[model samples]
Target: MTRTGSGHPRHSRPGDGQDSRRRRPPPKGRSPRRRRRPPVARTATANGLPSGPRGHWFLVAAGLLVVAAALTLDGYATGVVGETRPGPPAGFASAESAEVRRGGPVVNVTGDRPTSVRLPGRTVALTFNDGPDPEWTPQVLDVLARHGAKATFFVVGSKVARHPDLARRIVAEGHELGNHTYSHADLTAVPGWRLRLESSLTQRALAGATGLHTTLARPPHSPAPPAVTDLQWAAMKELAAEGHLVVLTDLDAEDWSRPGTAEIVASSLPAGGEGAVVTMRDSGGDRRQTVEALDLVLERLKGEDYRAVTVTEAIGMPSAHRRAGAVDRFFGAALNLAQRASETFTGVLRWALFIAGALTLGRFGFFIVLAGVHAHRTRGGTRRRNAVGGWPSPPPVTVIVPAYNEAAGIQATLRSLVATSYRGELEILVVDDGSTDGTANLAAAPGFPGVRVIRRPNGGKPAALNTGIAQASHELLIMVDGDTVFERATIGRLVRRFADPAIGAVSGNTKVGNRRGAIGRWQHIEYVIGFNLDRRAFELLDCMATVPGAVGAFRRSALVALGGVSGDTLAEDTDLTMALCRAGWRVVYEENAVAWTEAPASLGELWRQRYRWCYGTLQAMWKHRRAVVERNPFGRRCLGYLTLFHVLLPLLAPVVDLMAIYAIAVDDPLPVVAAWAGFVLVQGLIGWYALLLDGERASALWILPLQQFVYRQLMYLVVIQSLATALLGVRLRWHGIRREGTFNEFTQAAGRSLPAGGPRRP
Candidate 1:
């Protein structure tokens, strides 16, 4: 087979690059060996940040923070902070003069000086506060309309925004509207800015709901003019400057306490049948008493020939409602839409949290049960050997090590291969894919005479793996990364699985070799708990998705039948494994075949690696999506599980964190904390079990709780970025992590002797 200039082998069909076997001749005049420029050195800032493309994790964090802050504020402003008591603050003193105290409930302080007026004789001003409620307000409105009476409704802006139809209804039914502040914030209790904001927001809500703004202001929890305190007077003056007439109630029905309807009606009646401004509530609690009392009060007043009217009507003042301007209407509509959207988003998040929690728990439980089944079924090699009628003769094997700037650990990889205890002919092939480092020279050094080094131009791991596959001399092949070191019996154990000819591929147990740092330990835990445990379940289900590149064994016939490796996705291993399964080949996990590989040492490196993996998996899933509808277990079991646990659940998992924060803000955090601790404990038990299965120290499970705070969030962000990239159709390249030669330390620590070689590079 001849390769193209791009290092990919030419195929017959465009979309069948991974399936076609008839390779074309090399392009005319293109030399088989071409010199390439040295790869660029990665630069870093003084602060040690990568001087490459910027990361978007900070942006993601900022977005989540903004959402949490909005939720917290919304909860607080919407009665979560609780209403101020219906009395002046302690130590408050009355500031009103005797004349003003004895005057009417309607007071205009916007003039050169404060002035007041009283309702006319036989006229009763019926005013309802903290209303425009969806339930009670309509009943109150119905009663007023039936009795031919018009009342003033002081509407909370938040409620009006939430139930705009009710606000519009209040105005449409010939009822007057008053500004009761956006959250019903007490004027005397809040700061000057908050007081202004509350009033302004209410005006906006009214304008959006009814295309009108109200100048009739009512301070929440305020008493009659006689009880107006100094601080209350100052707030009223500020409202006066903003063109508002403070309306106070002369008669307090106190229906908010749900007092007896008879008592409510008695309190509502004016003293000696004099004209009076009466206050009652249609919202803020059960207002059944207020509703009943309202009908009786109107009936009794009608019998007494005392007409019930609006505040403006009783005081002989102009209508408090004014038509809003275009600007106010536009902004008010926008504000209304935004508030509604925030509320809708919060509701969706709550449901998403519930679903994510359920899915997570279900997946954990399923994995534990199925993995246990796998362990029990394949508990011993004796059963497997007996089923195959005794182990077959060992066959010659080829080991392929694809290297790219892996000079740090390539020799150790070669030495580990040479030291394998397999009783068969073993051939080692190291394909150096245009590495700028002296990786090819290092592999071809005289210390290792059995190893063959194949040099090719840079074409990524898939292309290099194909080159190695084409060059190998044996039928059985084991593929391993240059940074991984296998135990002496690993290759033998991996090859033993081939005794069952039905098995086309075997995935070795890959462990984190450099588990000294926090990042390393986290990766180690993920490997044991996440990858290895899931592989156990996938194996039993016959829907194996990935034979990891760190270490895997395959028959050369399977490779040839599938056109070697495909460069169609960054996760070529996963892509090839899925393709093999779809082609009627079985892939299984061999936990006894252990290989140690280095993990990313920094968060940035880990993010890049996982981002590529996630994005590539998405690509492969889409590429093979047709299998989902085909008559195959790969579709029925593998795709469904990946879609749920890997893609959908991860996308919704962030909602759980956001809900936790919101709960802590508005409600008791003990439940949230307890829920989180319970989840972590479950995960800890699973991690400990995985470690026990893998023969690792359970002490490492201690870091699992802290992983939720940092490592888990990074993984979530990676998934988000990957999904965004896939949705936006952004093409991503395979990103490689820098090698740290950490696997060598693992080998040295295990007292494994290495083949003598030239001095190692620092």
Candidate 2:
């Protein structure tokens, strides 16, 4: 569990750390077998002034997928997914050299104003907002009238126009008018023209209500664009020339959430009480609590004999330590970002990882919906009875099943291929990888006829796949692992996408074949959400990085052009996808084409599989760094996606993690708890979508908290171990994935690279 002193994946047998069998076995109903997998190492501006908001969730998904791919990259890879920034610049040459320098002590208020004001008699101020509500505004006014208290009402233009009577009632009821803009949109998104529009419309709406003569405005959502306050202040000056003032808020009831009356009372009423806030929200929907809270504040203030008055009454404000501290904290953050950007290029990579992952996922969502729409328009679908024998013929296809000591799975895989729905001119090739098991003999038996067996010394998986691809007679090459099986229509659907000619490869959605165990179920979620959905986004981005090796179709021309997969990278499939992209070919992802493949059913197997993948990714990125600066469209697109999302940002993810842990474990309670809660909330929001996409809606809520321990910590370990080896150039001796014995066989860890997964040749 402790860090193994930061080295490349330890090239020892699974038992070397502690037992015997390297892999666990395949699932139930399948023969016992061991197989090996090759080891590989690896948003948004709601913009102001933009004509449209565009993107939505599809673009967001694209960004997530790109980051996910960068996650696959080995730490050594450059550009987006790999390490790009140095951790905070170490104690800069001088604090003066900082890019974002700290300014003077945080100012509390521009002018002296009293923290409190008292008059000889009792004094109090009342606030209302988001009014012009036909249902609630009048009731609020009536209550104020009964209490004989003067109040202020903040109104939005649209609502004022809709219910002018309500606005007039407030004025008639002795309440002052305040501006709250026109459309009620978040003001953070309003700037320049819209900024002016906000003030203009509010005045117009107010003119319609009572008078065009008044002045005052409160931003919607307490959100103001850059310099919004200053701009408003300047406008206020012009209005003041005619005698008017602008008001800002210090007290908030958070009434927008409709906290019940009691909760509202608790939040708004001060310890001693009588309260004054320049702004508030409409409270009638559920304001019994708010009303109760107001009464409570009134009681306390009356008891304490303190006075609450308008800004005009308070002459000198209290000390500003808290507000100053906030500015100081902002300064610290700016410093931290600057420092980190210098050390290893963390900013660029973090940005890359975030951008790439998001784009990848967003694009996937887009295509899924797009394809769905396209299908609906064409009267094409998985459920419409297939109009006879599935869609139109998709040329001929050669199904290749690569096997090494895969006796347990060999027959099953061959059988599955033979049973496929595209019964026309189909060929099955089982390239045997010098199986110690009698995998070859079983293939020669009578039950399988059209299946051909080609035996070769095990150089590696790429070698096996290359041999099969070479002997294939058809241009449409389908690759399915011996331990995997396709749904009846998977083959036909996958091949059909190639009709576009531009698509050189089409990935089949791979699901977990074994779902009985907890480990397997966890992996099931990973595959559906993390892998398949991610690919959809990747395809949409034109950077479908890896057409999964588990089950996919590739154009034979594209396959041959890439020189039949090289041993240069552990993940030849991923490497091939990149090469194909570089070769100007596109890879498409088909969610309907599902192939169920066996997951490593155990933790040890899973780590090794992931280690190889990470290592291979790093190797791939290193091989292709030239794409970053290259002018080719594919090169530019891939590089931008990689550098911004994968390389810089994620390498620093552990930084974010450690900082979070640091924030949580601190001695003080407030900041730590705040950090913990914020982190969890953000992650939960994201996890909700990921789980919803993965079809584990029930688990999403629970999964967020659990991830911090199980998934998060484990991820840090993977990153550390992967990085050490990657940066140090340590080589992984493990040859590739060796299957486990039957899922029920219960074999222990054995050989160096080969796990127990491969079926022993019977």
Candidate 3:
């Protein structure tokens, strides 16, 4: 079973690497008609949850919708379904004295129902509805104060809660207080508990603001007493039971309709020398007419020998104001806080939606720009690295494969390395980072004869790589993850780029190996479209952000100059690469060198893995923040680029995702879908181009839209969680993904054609 130095058997064909562009046929005996496995379809919960928090967004939206519906129901019930009290026009009412003298059953509260009070002299009570409004309440109050008149304001509880100072001013100005019910809800239409809350909460707010509780109340939209329906009467009686004085007006001044002042004044005079309770609105829409007509009405009333007074005073009944006790004050404070909290939540949600949309759009625009720039840079083909002279005749290289619970893929990774086609001295060093599995034994097994295994305590990947660097016999080092399987020419291609003396590091192209499932396909698209193209751009600028752990080559002297891999951040590769650039070493990309690595099998695993990567990248960026102030090209472009694209863009990406959720939940879905489709279309074009550049297939683009719905959100969450954790000073331990040796497909396919492979290293 002796195999070639390329790790493939002697009979192996060309294009045997895990290059998706090259499709290999079945071996001599095997059937060429093998059925491809279908993508795995994972089931969702009863609610059809794809991912955990994504489903929770729907729940949140549903809850908000419920709250909004309740508020709408209350508003509609008050405005349309409930009662509207009809008042007599001026010069028409003559029952003022008769009704007062014809009162039935002992009434509890004065002004509870319109009082037909026959005062000692000709007197009229002026009452305003729906007020404490900032614009008009003051004008009405000023007019009343100027004319030496006092009015009763039945204020909406919500309005009072918002403008408590206005409520206080009303009491301070010698005006009477009355409840218009919270949010002006119709008590006759709502349930019993809601009715109670509507009444009581207003009382609490008024008491809290003015230290006086008003027993005077007017059911919203209720008509004059004689005209109230039996149902409205029943509701009024219920309020009476609660000790609320239901104020009904005798004269109707429909100034709320913006009628002329003369008409409003005409509507206010009492008929047949009877004292009437006059009604006008101070708030609830444009009230300029109300404010304007007040002085004219006052003058007319004075001329008619009618002294305008508070409802209680005109009715000769005691004031409804009760000084609030400590308990009442406390209740008022709690009620105010509750209302403010609701308002605050609504405000915050609106701001969040705006911010999310802005960030989402910004990020999309930035990605487009970056992709365009990347395409222009690598338009014809990959530009060569700045290494002094390309390493045409390569030097000896030591490959370090760091493993942590990677027993599943370590052998394949090592075999892939041993089979490299580089004609230089090469050795394999497997650093098992305290894997409880048989990673060490497997590496030292008889099958992998020349492979060297070094065991150490569970120090992280950075520590293990550092150990490998210290122990390596060669000056040229290649670092590979235990789960990554390299192609035969991957090492040679990567090493050749280091020929430029200034080129300190080269990042290799990474491909997703297990593209058998939907998740894998999504990641496959991302690797080809996102990461590889990003490297091409980074390489053009001589500021490669990360020399991926999957496959990268570096000069040992450059590594030592930067003190090897630093454990200060979780993303050692990125940290090291940035450090190299900051230290005046150029880090470039090598697209020809390809390595196949397993993508996470499930969402949970994908989240955990990406969480670590995103978090580490942020930490690394922060550690190198000082680079932003440097004057070099590395600082100007590399640090500036990282700060803008990597740091700022990621932060904004989550907001965009949130805006997407908001749009889907609240706005029209068509525009949202259209915008998203447009973004995806652009993304697909870039991905397809990148795949073509990297010599891979575009078939994986089919899952690009699905990725937007599922994978894109998961990635955004990862970025958000990572940023939050980093900002909050929370440290996350390394989380390893469950690997199932995805490279076995490539190995199985290769083995079918090739003869036995004797492990060969240059």
C-alpha lDDT of all candidate models, in order: 0.79, 0.55, 0.70
**How does model 2 score by TM-score?**
0.49
Tell how far residue 242 is off in model 1, in angstroms: 1.8
Q: What is the per-residue lDDT of model 3 for residues 660-734, given as tens digits with 9 covering 90 to 100?
A: 565566446798789788877877777777777776777768888888778876876677666656654454555
Best by lDDT: 1
Candidate 2: misplaced stretches above 4 Å? Answer: 1-394, 643-647, 667-704, 734-762
Per-residue CA lDDT of candidate 1, range 1-762, in tens? 000011112211124223423557678998566558554434323232334454555666777776775676467457654345455354444445344566667888876667888888899989999877788999999999999999999888888888899988888888899988888877877788878888898888888888999889988887898767777777888787777898988899988787799999999998676899999998888888888899999999999999888899887778899999988988888777777777777778778777878878888899999888877776765465532224566678899998888888887777778877777788899998878889999899876757999998766778788899999999889999988888788888888888878889999988877777899899989988888898898888899989999889999999999988987876788888889999988999987788778788899878777877787788889889999989886877888878887888777667667877767866789999999999999999988888888878899988888999999888877788777667655556556677788756545544443322211111
Q: How does model 2 fare in lDDT?
A: 0.55
Instruction: Sort the candidates on TM-score, descending order.
Output: 1, 3, 2
lDDT of 2 by residue, 295-358 (tens): 5555555566755443333323221111113443344333323332332344465565457546
User: Which structure is stronger by TM-score: 1 or 2?
Assistant: 1
- Please identify model 1 stretches exceeding 4 Å from their true place: 1-73, 80-88, 92-94, 97-103, 380-390, 444-450, 648-675, 724-730, 745-762
Poorest lDDT segment (10 consecutive residues) of candidate 3: 1-10
Cα TM-score of candidate 3 = 0.72
What local lDDT score does residue 341 receive in model 3, on the 0 to 100 scale? Answer: 60
- Cα miss at 298, model 3 (Å)? 2.6
User: Judged by lDDT relative to the true structure, which candidate is superior, 2 or 3?
Assistant: 3
What is residue 151's positional error in candidate 2, in angstroms?
Answer: 49
